[model samples]
Target: MRRNAQALFGLVILLAGIAAVVATRDWKIQTAMYPRVVGIPLVILAAIEVVLSLRGAPEGERQAVDTALSETLPPDVTARRTRVAFTWIVGFFLAIVLIGFPAAVPLFMLAYLRGQGRESWALSLVLAGVAWLAFELIFDRVLHLPFAEGLLLQILRR
Candidate 1:
C-alpha cells in the first residue's frame, strides 16, 4: 500500500511537470527559460521516481522507511514546539506589518535562527546581516518593488 501511494504521488508529480511544460509552450523561449529548465527536470525525476517505486521495496526496507517517516517528537514536546513555531510565524508577520520589510526581515531571521536553531550568536548575526543585504539588494535595489511604510510609521506621522 505504501509503495502504491508513493507510485501514485510520483504519477501526479509527472502530470504536474507535463502541465508546466505544456503551459510554457505558448510563451517566448526567453520568457519560458526558467519554467522549461525546472519543468523538464521535474518530469524526468518524477518519471524516475514512478519507475523506482514500481520496483518493490524489500520487505524490511519498507518497514524501516515507514518507521523513520512516522517517528516524531514526543506528544507533549511536539505540542509545545508546534505552539512555539506558530507563535514565531505570527510574530514575524506582525513585525513585517508593524516595522516594514527592511527591519522585519533581519529581525525575524535573527530571532528565529538564534532562538529556535540555537545557533551561535556570531553566526546568527552574520546570517541576519546577509539576509538583510540580500533583501535590500534584490527586492529593494534591483527589482524596485515599492514597500509601503509600516502601519506604525504611518500612524506616528499623524
Candidate 2:
C-alpha cells in the first residue's frame, strides 16, 4: 500500500511537470535553445515514471518489510522531518533568488549540512567550497553560463 502510494505520488508530480513544460512550450520565450534541450529530457523522464507506476511493483519481493516499517515509524517523526526538509529546500531556493547563485549555493549547502547535524565546520566549509568550485568554476566559468550575479554584480556595476 505504501509503495503504491509513493508510486502514485511520483506519477502525479511527473505528470504535472510534464504538463507545465508542454503547456509553456508554445510561449515565444520558450523558443530558445535552452527550453527544448531541458524540456525533452523532463518529458521523457515523466513519461518513464508514468509507465513504471502503472506497471506496479516486482512480483518476487515480499511485502512484510513495507508493512513493518509503515507500522514501526512514528507518524510525528516522519511529519517533522518532512516539514524540516521541505522548509530547508524552500529556504535554499529563496536564498538563491535573493542572494544570487554563487553566494546562495555555498550558504545553502553549509546550512543543510549543519541542519543534518554535521558538527565539523571545517569539513562543511571544504565541501561547500568544492561545490562552489564545481558549479561556479567548472560549469559557469568554463561553460559560460549567465549565472545570477547577485548583490556583488550590482555593486560592481555601480
Q: Who wins the TM-score comparison? A: 1
Residue lDDT tens for model 1, 19-104: 98999989999989999999998999999889888896454534543435224677678778778989999999899899898989
The TM-score measured for candidate 2 stands at 0.51
lDDT of 2 by residue, 1-158 (tens): 65677678877777776676777656787464566577678778876766666676464655656435344568789878878878988998878777798889889888877768575898888888899889987778788888776765677779
Q: Relative to the unseen true structure, what is the Cα RMSD of model 2?
A: 8.8
Error of 1 at 51 (Å): 39
RMSD of each: 8.5, 8.8
Off by over 4 Å in 1: 1-71
Per-residue lDDT value at 92 in model 1? 91
What stretches of model 2 exceed 4 Å from their correct place? 1-72, 151-158
What is residue 106's positional error in candidate 1, in angstroms?
0.9
